[model samples]
Target chain A: SQTIHQWPATLVQPVGSPLSLECTVEGTSNPNLYWYRQAAGRGLQLLFYSVGIGQISSEVPQNLSASRPQDRQFILSSKKLLLSDSGFYLCAWSVSSGLYNEQFFGPGTRLTVL
Target chain B: SQQGEEDPQALSIQEGENATMNCSYKTSINNLQWYRQNSGRGLVHLILIRSNEREKHSGRLRVTLDTSKKSSSLLITASRAADTASYFCATDESGGSYIPTFGRGTSLIVHP
Candidate 1:
């Protein structure tokens, strides 16, 4: 079975500080990874998605960026965090090029920018 | 652009009652998926209905898709307090677009 892991489970970052969240997939190779943010009482906003190493697609322009350093390793980073950058961040992975595979989610990282 | 938008942003229902949430989307799709999120945790995939299919069942959950109107509904039978969570609908236009677009989820509260 495939599983996704994300950490730190919870984060508290001061304003203007840097942020780094990591996501890794187990039991799968060449999976498509995605980063999503959910504001309180709002819908999820897709931040970035990566198909392969060194490749990423930004869905929305924000203070965050994502990278696929390895086939199953994805990282979401921010040079300087903003108050608006706080939200419940999720990492998901799906079978690469699969006909109808659902995206599996990680436990998720709750970031609070104070 | 968001492909799905849920109706009645929030719903409150008593335990043992049926809970139904609706999702509307734009464009044609290959399938529509329903997901549930508890508190601030990651979402769990509930069910997926393909375009050719009209309804699907998984345990106590039922999903119906209306392609002509570009809408879908998730029905939970005999809900419980533990079932209180937010539900989201994601549309996959698998014809050529590989990305699955998600919508603003519907928050369902099942009070015991």
Candidate 2:
């Protein structure tokens, strides 16, 4: 069975501060990783997705960025945070196959930028 | 732009009653899926119905897809309080791309 893990289940950051959220998957290799953000009472916004290491596709151009350092390790970072950056960050992984594989999600990180 | 949209932003029903939510989408899709999210937690995939299929069942969940109308519905039978959660529908476009576009989701509350 494959499992996903995210760190800093909850985070409080000040404006203009740096941000780093990590996600890793076990029991799977070369999986598709994605980063998503959900604002209060809003739908999820896809921030970034990576099909392989060192490859990242950004959906919405914003202050946040994502990187896949290893086959199963993904990181979301920001040089300077904004108030609008506050939201629930989620990490997901799916099988690297054809279209239409169900994605598995992690516990998620609740980030609050004050 | 959101590819899918869920109807009735919120719904409340008594336990044991049936709860049904609808989802509409734009563009052609290879498949549509339903997910459940508990308060302040990650989402769990509930069921997936391919575009070629009309309906599918998994335990208490029954999902129907109308490709002609570009819509889908999720019916939960004999709902329990534990079923209170936000339900979202995602669509995988017909193209080879595997990315799924998500909807705003419908919040369902099962009163005990």
Candidate 3:
């Protein structure tokens, strides 16, 4: 079965510090990957999605960026973090861009910027 | 918005009782899906109902979709304390739009 993995299950970062979160998928090939940020008691906000390597689409303009360095490896980075950047980060993968877009998520990363 | 907004933001009930949650969206969709999230964890896909279909069942979950009303409901029968979690609904439009919007989920607490 396919599974997604996210790193740093919990993180505490100081303001102005750099941020890096990684996500990888196993048992699947050429899967579509997405990055989402969710506030406490709030829905998810799409930050970035990639259909293939070196291709990324950003949804919201903010202090975060995403990169697909490999087929199944996605990275979320920021040069400097902001207080508003604190939230639960989720990584998800879908079958592809066409039919059966059902998404499977990875264990999230909770970041607290102090 | 393309998101499905849930009603009764929070619900509490006793175990073995029936729990129902409603979700409404603003546009046409190919399908609607329900997900469950335990506290501080990832979401698990619970059930999915297609626009062409009115109802679907899996285990103890019953999902109904009303395309005309652009609404969907999730009914959980014989609820248990282990079923306590946040429930979210998401809509997938007919077109090829890949971005999915999700509303603040409905929090459910089942006391044993």
The candidate scoring highest on lDDT is 2
Worst 10 residues of 1 chain B by lDDT: B92-101
TM-score for the first chain in candidate 3 comes to 0.98
lDDT of 3 by residue, A31-88 (tens): 9999999899998888999999999999888999999999999999999999999999
Off by over 4 Å in 1: B94-96
Candidate 1 docks at the CAPRI level of medium
DockQ score for candidate 1: 0.69
Q: Model 3 chain A: which ten-residue window has the lowest total lDDT? A: A94-103
Give me the candidate number with maximum DockQ.
2
Instruction: Write candidate 1's Cα lDDT for A1-114 as tens digits.
Output: 888899999999999999999999999899989999988887778889888899999988888898888899999999999999999999999888756758899999999999
For model 2, the interface Cα RMSD in angstroms equals 1.0
lDDT of 2 by residue, B1-112 (tens): 7998998899999999999999999899998999999999998999988889999999999999999999999999999999999999999788748688889999999999
Residue lDDT tens for model 2, A5-109: 999999999999999999999999899999999998777888999999999999999999999989999999999999999999999999998566798999999
Q: Is candidate 1 or candidate 2 better by DockQ?
A: 2
DockQ ranking, best first = 2, 3, 1
Best by TM-score: 2
TM-score between candidate 2 and the true structure: 0.99
Query: What clash pairs does model 1 have?
Result: none
Question: Predictions ranked by TM-score, top down?
Answer: 2, 3, 1
Pairs that clash in candidate 2: none
